[model samples]
Target: MLIYAHRGASADFPELTMAAYEGAVEQGADGFECDLRITKDEVPILWHNASMLERAGNRGLIAEMTYKEVSRAYPQVLTLDTFLDYAIANKKGVLLETKHPVFSGNRVEELLVTALHEKKALAKIAVSVMSFSWLAVEKMRRLDSTINTTFLMHKNTPWFQARFSSSAAIGPGMNELRAEPMIAKKIQSLGRSLNVWTVDKDADIHLCQKLGVDILITNKPAHAREVLGYP
Candidate 1:
């Protein structure tokens, strides 16, 4: 099992902040989760929402601006390349989640692979296909079948099982883990790894550890690690 820092140890620092990611690496997080969306100019930036306007202090939308425009708007905001650079320098693995389905048909994987190879970080990370659209994961598989992929789900059902074989693992929603223990077991038995997401409390971390999930995605990885004795 591994501990993945959700949004780069978001509870300690601002979500998606470079400082937060740095903190995660120091705490021995095996990997970090990051969300990707496009800027107005079609440049992919590290963001979790449809826009970054909510988190920006006295700033405009990250999507309404070009890459350079966004840089000026939120100087602290990190582009995908910038974030990956830092992760590579620190040797932190990343679970890059694709937030946009329509535009992420195939280009997302291309850009990510190209950037990782260019920065010599390809083998250090895994690109996860987290879109509601199955087509996104299919595209990713097409891009590179070797790239580890995961399906984000709230439950296990026939629909999920049909596509389950294609994924390397499944990321169960935090709210559904205990309620769907049977489903989790089934997923694990299928030879696919089980990972739980967005767990923040100490109790939840312990519970996830008890379940033997392959990865516990948490906002407080350092604390969760302490609770789990992950180091």
Candidate 2:
């Protein structure tokens, strides 16, 4: 399985920052994964939370601030454009997760599609849009079926959701997969690929390998490489 850095080697560096992605590349990650959020000015930015309190120590909502304002609040912040440029330059595959239920509605998916189309990212590297919201995945498929989409599953997500989704892959948390190993076969049975998230443990890594997971998302790419005996 290919090892994709979760939030860009987030265990060693701040999540969704340039530093994190840089660390990911240095650690020999096959790809990069990030969470995308839009600012008030419609600029796509790499951010995981609606409020900046967790990462930036500011209480302001990201959707209410422009990119400039966000930069001022947290200078290390990375935009989607900036991240895409870095990924393209480094020849890294990209797995972009569009956070849903935001104030901007489905504008995130639209902007992402526009950016990918303008950048011709599909021609250069592997790119997949993933989301926990089934509607968001469907929206992405509608916006551009050529681009791949993955429907993310959490503890609360229905098992049958993946069967009906338009996504090319099904993403389940490592814990979910551990609890139900059959999920792997079930996903494969649907003719969909498996992309497991945040798989950090050695056992989890072995499980992913045994189950033929297509992509293994993790915070420690170097360690995963070591565990998998990859030079």
Over 1-231, each residue of candidate 1 has an lDDT whose tens digit, in order, gives 688888887888888878889888887888889887777677878777765567775355655668887767677677788888777777667788877543345566667656766776666655454544456666677777877777777554345543454777777777787676666677777788877798887777777777878888888877887887765
> Total clashing residue pairs per candidate?
0, 0
lDDT against the true structure, each candidate: 0.73, 0.95
Worst 10 residues of 2 by lDDT: 158-167
Evaluated against the true structure, the overall lDDT of model 1 is 0.73
TM-score for all models, in order of appearance: 0.87, 0.99
Which residue pairs does candidate 2 place in steric collision?
A: none
Quote the positional error of residue 37 for candidate 2 in Å: 0.4
- Output the number of the lDDT-best candidate: 2
- Where does model 1 exceed 4 Å of error? 57-63, 102-106, 125-129, 155-158, 161-165
